[model samples]
Target: MSGVARQIDRPRRWLVVLVVAVILFAGAVVAPSTGITRMGPFGLFAWASWLHVFGYAFLSLTLVYALLVSPDGPALSAAIVPIIVVAYGTSLELLQLLIPYRSFAVGDIFADGLGTVVVVGVWTYGQAAFAALGFRGS
Candidate 1:
């Protein structure tokens, strides 16, 4: 395959996952009651909205993992992912306000941002440690 095609293949799955994640999360926010998601232990007996952040946290970890696996991945993308996460979370909270059942809460944003921070910090630190040891592969 040509260089461009090969390059495209690498991030193609990322793009797909990114889109699906956004859509699914959007669906969760647009009609949270219709959308049912469970996080098992991560739920911690919290409301589904809160546990939804936990799901995003895991999604963030997947994105970070994909970024780490890519040779051309940059720290800038690692940093920006959290911003995307925060913005997405902010938007979701705003959307939730429209739902009669869901009220916008500062707590949700805090939870989402906290999750984003944890994912980015852990991912970045792991990348640094792996680079030091010359580890590779997803």
Candidate 2:
């Protein structure tokens, strides 16, 4: 493909990734947790906590990638992506309150925020390092 075509397609690809990530997150959040802890190596709360971290981390990364690939994306994507992800996480947690089988947990929010911060921090620093080494990054 031509460079122009590739450039135009990048944002679309990332947006698709972002959408998939969101759908997966919602599915995992709303699904019944009956057998999850028993199946996972980590017991009970640990498994759920790790899920919160990894899920939000992936979601945040996809969001950042989508924004970064867009021509008119925000100048401070690293700053905004975490806020967006955390807010989304919080909203999901609040939604759990209405579900009879699901209850809200503040710890899950903390895990989500932790994941967003770690991923965004590493991404920002990795981009800087690549730039310092004279490499172009997206």
Candidate 3:
């Protein structure tokens, strides 16, 4: 491979590790008790549901950075981010056990997994859509 290629790819090893670290670290912080709800037709799925979209957004950003460094495409990054997220999430849940006001909620893990699926789905579809629009890449 070219030296330039090596230069680009080499940094990604640490970049991925760093991004994963930041995500995991951030998850440990207890979220303020902001009631995620709404009064719309499907209120139950409004605010809390929106969190999934935010998760997708962050995951997408992470994928873009992943691609920028390695050019491996979003699919590969999508496949890996969740494992990092889940391990970190589970650890955070366990860590919260130490707090007097918090308890582990398995539903949060399900929500996180669903959010991850959303991220992967959007990345896959986004790549397809961009290709359909005549964009292609390495």
Candidate 4:
């Protein structure tokens, strides 16, 4: 790697750190009755499942970006992002079990993991294509 390239990668290290922090915070957030937990602005808990899928998709995409930026940020393993996302989703569901109105559901976990898998697959193929085209700086 060129020295200039290495210098440019330094800033990305902080970006990866920020992304990891966001993922952790998002995973631990309490499920709200409306807003992000729901679909529309007025509807309450309407189409909540699709919200979970959407939220997790963004989270997964952020995680994939972090992995692509820095493979050795703390203990973050690119290969384990999907597993971690699924585990985080499972933990969220478990937390919901204690809430008064929230009910734990396996479907949420599936949706979250599905999001992670889709992002990971896309990132993997993107990197592969980049490499094939001689673009090595991820």
Model 4 residue runs over 4 Å out of place are: 1-46, 71-77
C-alpha lDDT of residue 24 in model 1:
45
The residue-by-residue lDDT of candidate 2 on 27-126, one tens digit each, is 5457666665553454446677877888888887877777664555445668998998889888888888888878788998998999999989998888
Q: 1 or 3: which has the higher lDDT?
A: 1
Local accuracy of candidate 3 as per-residue lDDT tens digits, 1-138 = 686876777577558656755664465455635565463235555554455335534654564456433544334555676676566556766877887766676765666667666676776678779889998765
TM-score of 4: 0.66
Clashing pairs in 4: none
| Model number with the top TM-score | 2
* Cα-based TM-score, every candidate: 0.68, 0.79, 0.59, 0.66
- Per-residue CA lDDT of candidate 1, range 1-138, in tens? 577875887687588558757764665456455434454455563565556567667667766655545556543568877777777777877877788876787777777778878888887787789989998644
lDDT of 4 at 28: 47
- Per-residue alpha-carbon lDDT of model 4 for 11-114, expressed as tens digits? 77657646754664454465554554545545544466666666677777766665556533324556787886787778878877877767788877877777
Error of 1 at 131 (Å): 1.9
What's the true lDDT of residue 131 in model 4? 82
List per-candidate RMSD values in Å. Answer: 3.9, 3.1, 4.7, 5.1
Q: Report lDDT per candidate.
A: 0.68, 0.77, 0.60, 0.67
Off by over 4 Å in 3: 1-28, 34-41, 45-53, 56-60, 67-77
